[model samples]
Target: MAFDATRAGADATELDVLIVGAGLSGVDAAYRLQTECPDKCYAIVEARDAIGGTWDLFRYPGIRSDSDMSTLGFPFEPWDSDVSIADGDTIRQYIQNTAAKYGIDEQIRFGHRVTDANWNSEQACWFVTCQTAAGEQLFRCRFLHVCSGYYNYEAGYTPAFANRDAFGGEIIHPQHWPENLDVAGKRVVVIGSGATAITLIPSLVKDGAQVTMLQRSPTYVVNLPRRDAIAGKLRQVLPKRVAGSVTRWKNILLSMYFYQYARRKPDSTREKILHFARQQLGDAVDADVHFSPSYKPWDQRMCIAPNGDLFRALRKGRASIVTDHIEGFEAEGVRTRSGELLEADIIVTATGLNLQLFGGAELRLDGQPVDTGKRLIYKGMMLDGVPNMAFAFGYTNASWTLKCDLTAQYVCRLLQRMDKRGEAVCIPERHEGVEADDMVDLDSGYIQRAKGFLPQQGTKAPWRVHQNYVMDLAVTRFTKLDDGTMRFQAAPSRSASPTQTATQAA
Candidate 1:
């Protein structure tokens, strides 16, 4: 049931679990809570008016899933289409369908933006504050689950280029694409060589725009067919769910193998990727200058152009790639450091994302504030020293849903164990002398920029994020609940002196 704290007062409705965000992760969390912990009453508090998260938010030209839908889609729900990499609109519809099919939509409280979550040790409950359309509201819950994603939704990362304001043409960011921006028969210049730029160039070209991709440096790009034949064949003989499971595992293993191969045999893998790009472009362009990246393959994310669309556009003279630094924005277009002038009717800054954690919500334990930057992450889901909280952050090396599904299952298990043990408070204890490392081991601009804000990883098990989905599957699904690092305690009696911490061995 929905509660209006503004009209009904602060402590209006109490919930067993309170989930933040209505995206894929949030929906998955809600489904798990409803199924695994059926007795618990939970509500999803979405800041946005709609669901689908990144899929719904990104509406730029040719926006699609970088990962295959077999692994990216939910395990319970099979993607019926032959297209492995789906477009944004199709993915959005899939999410919406999933919510409706499971009746998860009814539990969502839209337009509720979580501003702060404070844990009361004495009461063993969290008082969650949100900024709603009506007014400020409060929610009380036994557990708090954050699935708000890792990037800022309001804006994309845009660098302040010199003389940007002097540009005569309209400058746009892919994050905030105008609904009716005309691009037909126009000269378009896209800034950045990442996934978004690659996806945009082909799309803009198809739309009758003569597009040019201007990049500071090259990123690894590979071409794969739009449809997966193996998945298609399996679907003919097997049930939808079975085929989906088979395809998902096959993709997961293959992705992991390729990532490992790239790490172990960087030079060969890089050569193979560049060779493939050359095959697609033929003699139209120099793959060495435009496709060869300075860094090794998988140093950052490798860009995949479905059905070689980007290469086809370049080969057909619909689009071109320029590897040069931008000196500044000229009145007509962009001026390069090499003194080359490129005129454009529109400039697109497909730069990157601005990473954010927990929707930038302030967290407090008891009466003291919690600084996530200083704390270590426990099992890649829970922050150390934070009680009754879990965040669904997915794997960087594979499809995001693969890791998030495991995380949801683990959280449900935890709740059930706590209930069985009659525990009201559970927290991960940080031991002294434990070495801390960077949260993510990526050299990408976004990850590097947000390092100070992300939670640190530890050197040992449970504290470190393996990033490998197979390894995490074992750790998250089968691991002991009462590990040595985690401490669980029952609620204190009214006449009791104070709260006490109890530690147990794994």
Candidate 2:
């Protein structure tokens, strides 16, 4: 895994499908394509030394999934673990196991950081440039699938504060959490109110740090336990598949009901959830100040785990919540707008990640550039007018794996449809009269942050992200495979002349 970054610079390699990441999405895509089209020449080029994607990168204390493992884990693989919520190490192990099970590890090229990719319209191929431990290398491929994920590979956003340079204490970003960095007994101030901040506060407090969660605004925080004992016990006694099915259904129904309630009865539902947080924390804390949010639930992201360890941590007095506007940074602490300075020996910016459009990688079709910002999403898989390329994006409301599973299945269907019709390429184009607003997804910072740079989907079927597995399965999995949205044309043979060739050489 030791990459010299100098050796790989020698030459460019040609591949039928050049995958730019080895993360869950990338690995999943490779798994699907390899199984479906075993003859296709493909390689997964990863920037890191090992696989596991996000699981490998995030190794902070108490790193675990926010959602239940049943839904979070891949569909083909059942997470047969008794525990409903899994920790970071377990998740990492699961990923490794899954990769090995599917023989995906061997195909992943570690330490392969993609620097640039330019699509050649005339050749119908992509010239990809990357840097590895060995050196820089170019890869030519007929198709490119960027599973780099939405988060910028670098650190998440950290606002410039006055006198930050003068501060001598340790500063860390969650994305770049060091293995040897110690927080034990240090006065730790975790800045941000998203899932990372919530997860880290309780974790660091257990490590003997006086943790304080600093937030600009309140987020909907629900307290749940780390394990669902009843569910675990049932799973232990009943068959794993049956138990998994039951648990999955329960979680899905509950999630759907909550989402429906939030959308239909926003005020009452918000009060109900806020009450739950207050009950968990008790009267010692200011519920109105720390838990109140201006927006409805799910309008922003909701943080949850099996049992609310964060609430327990707060109630135990190991951690405290500070909802205020940060003025700036002092030498040894954070200065608030109220003129109070909260001293911290270490500051962890657990701020949210910056969502990149198409994993921040550029896209082009033919000679003309295809700006994702200006495009529309076709069935949330392919972009309108982009030929022979498809993206894997999951559900925003439910577990990511479910939507991704559907996407993979749908891609297979699309490919099969093309093959049956003897089409060389299939492109889905949006109708002329479609309005812009219908395509816009005005939700959390994760989606809205790159609204323009992302492909737009309408509120109706195919475009709408229902998050309901049954609804999606009906549409994406079992719907008529041959849809009229896709245009088909015959593929010219390899010996075809320049004017007649349908595909460019990789």
Most accurate candidate by TM-score:
1
State the lDDT of candidate 2 residue by residue for 343-460, as single tens digits. 9989898867777655555565543567877667777667777766666666666777776767766776665665567555666767665654434333665566666676666545
* Best candidate, lDDT: 1
Q: Candidate 1: minimum summed lDDT over ten consecutive residues — where?
A: 495-504
Poorly placed runs, candidate 2 (over 4 Å)? 1-16, 118-127, 136-142, 438-443, 459-461, 495-506
lDDT of 1 by residue, 1-506 (tens): 33233343245456778999888899888888899888778899988899898988889999999999998988888888779989999999999999999999999999998888888776677778899888988887878999999999999999989999999999999999999777999999999999999989988987889898999999998898789999999999999999998998899999999999999999999999998889989999999999998998888988889999989999988898899999999999999999988899999999999999888788988657788889999999999989989998998778888888888888899888887877777899999888999988778999999988799999998799898988998988887988899999986563111111111111
What lDDT does each candidate get? Answer: 0.87, 0.73
Show the colliding residue pairs in model 1.
Answer: none
lDDT (0-100) at residue 214 of candidate 2?
A: 91
TM per candidate: 0.95, 0.89
RMSD of each: 5.0, 5.0
